[model samples]
Target: MSRPQLESDVRSAYDEVADSYADRFRSIEPEEAIDIAMIEHFGSLLQAPKKVLDAGCGAGRMLPVLAAMNCDVEGVDLSPGMVRRARRDHPSFTTTVASLTDLPFPDSCFDGYFSWYSTIHLPDSELPLVVDEVRRVLRPGGVALLAFQSGTGTRDVSEAYRRHGHDIVLERYNRTADQVAAALSVGGLQEVARLERSAVSPHERDGQAVVIAKV
Candidate 1:
């Protein structure tokens, strides 16, 4: 909530290094077995052309997974460069530049929503607006799987990147699982499940939070 610059920082930061980011995250890793399994489960639960939105889908990390699952998926990112790389990398899919706090789609436009490691950049003050936007874009009974780090405060990953000779970026916001669930409920989504896993790296929180909900 402190830095309103985060919104603009995210876009400029990502756009400046989209190519490098895309090259790095063009796909998921093999050691991410558990993570991939969760994604697969979420994708399998939806039918073909069910209309799913990949909220903040940077460089199209979930493109292949969702495509194989047969869900009609589209991606939206705050950085135009990320959108361009995603489209270039996954030509079969459609990608656009849009903000989660203010999505571009019409009301009740999608049947499912997927946001993996995206909202980590949003300040708490902005999280509710995003949740409300998600609710507005979902049809009745529409499902959503949102993921983020589990903890409090924010991490300035940009400094770390700069030290590593990489481009700077925005802070990663952390929140408890309860915080996410309560916000979703207030935004008209009912939490159906909670998934947690120990953080695989020291840079992460004690664990991660993935909340599954439905309208």
Candidate 2:
């Protein structure tokens, strides 16, 4: 899809699912486990970053925890409703409406970045640009924690996600370990650790992958 189409799909899909999606997965359990794994894996690479950017941060589920750790944390999402909810739930931080293709921040603006289960909404063709944008916004030696569902091929729009009022056409690319490593390398990130785990949700039975990378 072209940029306009991509933006349209995202705006529509997210606007539709904003309310229910936030209510469903706004807690810290699943992501907290992932975060803990990330912190342990990348602790040495990260000299205790003080500022963090949660890219594609839906409902700000992880924002409060980062803030509690005394990190100056903020979140950005494509959905206005999601941003609103993030603000309501994590009242101490900043939340903005933004997209990964065009980050609102400047180069080297943050010490760490977290993008959990968000970039999967983008089609494979869009992944590289988003990755580059992520790199562009992080300071040298900054760390990024990324997560996504693992699948074999690009997915067409699924009836299930559409029914839930998601406007975006989600594609699942079952990634091999090497493919992920190459993708990160192209974006100037070096992987420090990789975690593969069984999916906790039936909808995600294919499993999930988390990577800790340094910029």
Candidate 3:
């Protein structure tokens, strides 16, 4: 499918189930360890009161953790319902309905940007534009955290971790570590670390590689 169609499908899919999906993964336990590692990583590079934008922050699960760390955090997601849930659940932080392809904030508005597993929905052709948006919104010397499948395949809607809840139809743009690194470089980001995390999904279950980049 084309990039535009892929984006539309993604938005529609998430919007349809945003409420229930948010309720299901609303808890942060599954990602606690990863979030902790990310906090440690961010804390090492940024200081208190640093501004952060959590791209694709579904239901605002990571807001409180970042807020507790003394960072000024904000979240954005493609689904309006998800934004609504996030706002209701995390009144302490700010969130809005927006897409990674076109962030609504001004240039250099944040000191750090984190996408978690958000960018996985973007096709390879469109991924650079999203990354460019990240770079455009981040201040110089900013950092980013992104996660995606590691392999070679272009996938349509797919299921994963069924035990977690209803089957999620997430777009899978499985790419190699090197390809991802090159794509990151295209958006003016340099690699900080690449981690491979184990999964309970049908895809390569061994690990989900994450790349930390600096803008």
Task: For candidate 1, give the lDDT of residue 206.
Answer: 51
lDDT of 2: 0.74
Global lDDT of each candidate: 0.82, 0.74, 0.75
TM-score of each model, in listed order: 0.91, 0.84, 0.85
Q: Largest lDDT belongs to which candidate?
A: 1
Clashes of each: 0, 4, 1
Note the residue pairs that clash in candidate 2: 13-166, 13-167, 151-174, 152-174
| Reference-based lDDT, residue 47, model 3 | 40
Full-model lDDT, candidate 3: 0.75
Model 1 lDDT per residue over 85-179, tens place: 99889988899999998898899989889998888877788889999998999888788888888888777778756764666756787888899
Residue by residue across 73-152, what tens digits does model 3's lDDT show? 88999888788889888887789888899899889888888777787767778888987898899888888877676777
Stretches > 4 Å off in candidate 1 = 1-5, 167-169, 202-206
Question: Candidate 3 has which clashing residue pairs, if any?
Answer: 197-207
Pull out the clashing pairs in model 1.
none
